[model samples]
Target: MKEISCALRFMFSAEFWAMGLCWTVSLLASYWQLVLRRITGRCEVYPRSELPRNLPTRPVCIVTGATSGLGAAAASALSKEGFSVVLVGLSSELLSEAMEEIRKRNKDAHLKGFVVDLSSFCSILEFKSSLEKWLTDSDMHSSIQLLINNAGILATSVRPTPEGYDQMMGTNYIGAFFLTKLLLPLLKTSPVGSRIVNVTSFTHRAVFDAQINEDIVTGKCFFRSKEYPYARVYQYSKLCLLLFTYELHRQLNLDNKPWQVSVLAADPGMVKTNIMQEVPFSLSNIAYLVFRVLGLLQSPENGINSILDAALAPSHVSGAYFFGGEGRTLRSSALSYNTRLGEKLWNISSNMFFDLKLASQATSSSS
Candidate 1:
């Protein structure tokens, strides 16, 4: 009887109660932000008409995956800020719809839609060519003030791209890497200092024990045969993104160019988005449902603030990881800070791009 009573006391200890209280308060806060504020339309930083206008003076911001969810929200906010916003996505129809939706809120908003499938390196290169052509046609060599690498996928099954690489890794990390590399000239030439915001996630912390090489090189680590869950694969991809961000920052500083470019990683808190649609009826789904019931999911508007914060931060804050809406710089995983690992990943990705380019050239010659 005494043992049972002692166990009960321990279970109800002050530390446990305090932890429970903190979690409850966090849930309530999330609910208020996601539900009440969103419904009231009070979540936006600027209303239509109040957003800045006049593209010549305003900065230009390029946002990938801007057709939906947090990407759309961030693009809209940037439009409000009077930036010449470029929305890049896979669907022309969705891009049109997204631009129209932003214009509905701010009729004077300057927005352009460009369709590019981030999962394909060739598609990204094509996008770069199209962008250059458009700029040339417009007689505009304007520096891009901000580039937001936000396109990503959460695949339930292991699907490799035509390049024989994991779809998730290709889209989430390599695509962004190649795109950023291709656009480095534009970013460097911007009249004002440039910023690159890579949208990462807190789930990257889950990759502490992951085999990074297998995941990035062959996608074997994420195979169903290995029993590695889809969620973990997504997390691993984000981990690679964070590493890329750090490495890019290092390279930018090394270049010592007059036009400064800052690289930042942003972790948007879990937001209500269609990203979860790919998850089947599994423990992941059950956990998501539990989070929803507990009011732990954030609104898309709130989720994007961290990204915006990173994009608008001062140049000195480069190589920093910002968290949630607060936009506070936080330490990422220890692996993320490993310079050797980052360099290795960079070399491997560069080699992959080189191999793809070689293959394309060979095929063209043969044809």
Candidate 2:
């Protein structure tokens, strides 16, 4: 009886110790987050009143994922600044509503919406052609000055697109890659310098153990041959964008092209967006509520500030990442910048397009 009593006592002691450690860790994390928010608040990094006066009479800004979240907010703000806004998204209903909202705020803003799902290469091709036709049709082919790659997806379960690429990677990287390439000429033709804002994330720090494996392009499976974790996949996608942003900036600046091309990345910093609400994970509900209590977390308004800042800033600081709309350092994984990996990713992406060359041919012929 004494032995059993001692065993029960030992078990109770272990449980108490475990509970204590958990609470301690949670408290420390909360404190750290609070400190981070305080530090970020002191950084006044947004370009609030610094819009250039020499802006063209018909300056244009293209904002993807403008149907919702920071994309919608940024597009609306740019329209108020008198930009001819081109909004891209997959939903016509949401697009229409967003257009109406922008018009209400800026009656003179030339607002247009195009429906394009960033998940499919074919749809992206169509969207590219549509943008080209619109530009040619309107004679403003040289006026597009800003391209904001803001559209993204966060799925609970890993699903492959019709193109055999992971859905997250397809929408976030491949579509964005093609869209930026197609719009290069238009950006080059801007009267003033042109800017490209790639909306990446702080979550990219989580990619310490990952790489841009060829499976991201050709293989029909993900790691573990099961549904990929949404957070992990999203982080990988952002890492790819981050690497591309750096590489593209280096190449463009090296050439010293006619137009001063600057590429900057922005992280909205835990914004109140529907992406979190739509994440299919079981713990996502608790995570959402916790973020809600954090005072430093971003609203959609705050989220747009960084994107707009990168787009409108006069001084070109190319190839830098911005968090919360100001210049910030990234704690990226070393593997993310591995030249060999970046080259591999680029080659895979290039080949994917080449493999589907026939579909592209059909698209151009139809166009």
Candidate 3:
């Protein structure tokens, strides 16, 4: 009884909680510092200024996962830069709040919200059609200067969407792929070279450990239990996303299209985002607490710099991978850059999207 009491006391004590929180924040801070140092050859948050005085006028940007965290920050930043910002997410309440915040920051800014549940591909398709129609109907048609795929989901157990693809892949890869494809025409309608930014992470390197077996892609792989760690599943999804980004860049370059559509990949240096809340267990709670205590960590605003830099940097060209913030080019994992891996991911995603379309059609016909 005494031991149990002591353990409970320790767990609940302010000192223990404070220490854990401090450590988590410090770890994330240190991680970001290291990344900035490597990419810029210096240690500091990617130093940036407000949008340049001579920047283009009335650029439009559509950003996913914008209700919170990196996505919201990116949209807010763009709003300040004089762009019409579209915030995408499923939460109507959050979307309203985000819109209000951006509105406050940019009084003349046109802020739109698309309530999208990215976990379902059908929902994404619905969003795509709605977005296209909305764009076409508005004066802002053909004004989209950038599309940022910043929204993501993390799940611990093996989960499948209604479309049969793994949940992580469905939200992170297939949804993103189809969204980009659907929006390509709108993106091309831009005045000049526009940008498409896909937010990825260093966690993608872990793909070497948990290789994507075919069974996993086919939904034949079962979740061992609900006890699986979310970080692992999240990393797998990012690995596939990074690979897909590389392949998409290659295809864009191969096509030699006249329009300047820059396909870029970026990672938000570690920040305190509630992304961990989706983890299956209580450890995620602990992790969040720890990160909150670390003063070394960045605010979401800091994390968005990389995505914004990649999107708006004047010098950036197509087919580049950028580390977020300062927007410098990054050397990704060798496997991510591997043509074979990228091709495999592309093939898998294409097939999955095809099936999703077929399934939707069959269901619609039956209904």
Candidate 4:
């Protein structure tokens, strides 16, 4: 009875209306830009070639969230390009499905699948250890050429990751940051022009300065489902990702020992994905109507064009944000470049993972 009463009260409260209004405005602002691009005929689709390459050696492309949606699309496309694509998903079964999907597109697709739950620190560390051993065993002939941090979620519930952080923030930003940091040494050994593409969104602009804090990661800010602003939380996660993208890009080129690797961000503006399914039926239904009515949602293939360009286009510069196709680029939110906020976020996030490094070592030794 109490739970029901609380839900009912929240549904009728001013907070609920305020949240809806904010989401509606953000959605319009973000999608309208894409709509204008489409109207101006600036969005052109990238084509794929199916021929398998017989090169002496191939570079590896690691794409997370490979089981479905844009991630799976990216994995398949990279495989077609003759890169030895390493597909990362949350489970072995999902990885198998992704590999199978890729092979269906190109029977000769060079692909490998690995399971790494981004929301779990132990899982990430274990996967890193396994990948390191694999690279060593394989004689280091094929180093990672590209990494796409594509796995993300828009969580409506107050679910905590295995590491007790907000699941969305953990998966969308921290997990990507951790995985990229762990792989930096390997990436340094990669081909001279290796690249890292951290996927971000325009929705990041929705998060204001005051909302950017450690509480976002500590899970205190989004602890209650009834009052949780799902759309804003999604924006918060993307904002953190954009900040990481900028800081990492800056750090990589710092101190005169510039890494050959290029770090960039891609915004696939309003793609159709399973992320919205987690929202309540009322909200999801409204979003669906808006998507259909405004022609705002795009297919995974159409959406990944920006991502593919970021990954494959040699002309791209590091720290650039690919906002749309046809070589379009845009400055991300002004707040995304706030160096102080970026440094603070970097320190906190790095410390969070560093704090877990000891625990991970202990657990592995025990096992």
Over the stretch 157-229, how does candidate 3's per-residue lDDT look in tens digits? 5677776667776677667888887678777767666778899876665555545555554433545443433
Selected candidate, larger TM-score, 2 vs 4: 4
Ranking by lDDT: 4, 1, 2, 3
Which 10-residue window of candidate 2 scores lowest in summed lDDT? Answer: 15-24
Candidate with top TM-score is 4
Per-residue CA lDDT of model 4 for 1-367, tens digit only, reads 6645645664776655655566556657755655676788754333322322332467778999988889998888888777888889888988998788778779989887888999888888887788877777776544577889999987756788888888888899889989988887777776555789998887787777735567776566677555666666777788888888889889988836564777888888767777666545555566667776877668899888888877865523678777666556666778989999888888988888788997877877999
* lDDT score at residue 305, model 1, on the 0-100 scale: 77
- lDDT (Cα, tens digit) per residue for candidate 2, span 1-367: 6645644543455433442244234334434544576687643243444455586456778999999999999999998887888999888999999999888978887988999887787787777778878877887745577899999977646677777777888888887887887678778877777788899876666566655667754324564565345556677788888888877776787775622778887767677677755433333444545666755457898877767767776556677566545433333446656767667777777777766767778777999
CA lDDT, every model vs. true structure: 0.75, 0.71, 0.70, 0.76
Candidate 4 displacement at residue 56 in angstroms:
5.2
lDDT of 1 at 316: 59
Candidate scoring better on lDDT of 1 and 2: 1
Task: Kindly list the per-residue Cα lDDT of model 1 for residues 1-367, writing each as its tens digit.
Answer: 6645644543455533443344344434433444555576644332112322333566778999999999999999999877879999989999999999999999999888998988887888888888878777666655677899999988756887766678888889888988998888898887657889999976676565645464445575555464435555677788889989999889888886722888989878677777766533342355456667865677899888778778777655688777646445556778889888888888888877788778877977999
Regions of model 1 farther than 4 Å from truth: 1-57, 218-228, 281-289, 292-295, 361-367
Which candidate leads in lDDT? 4
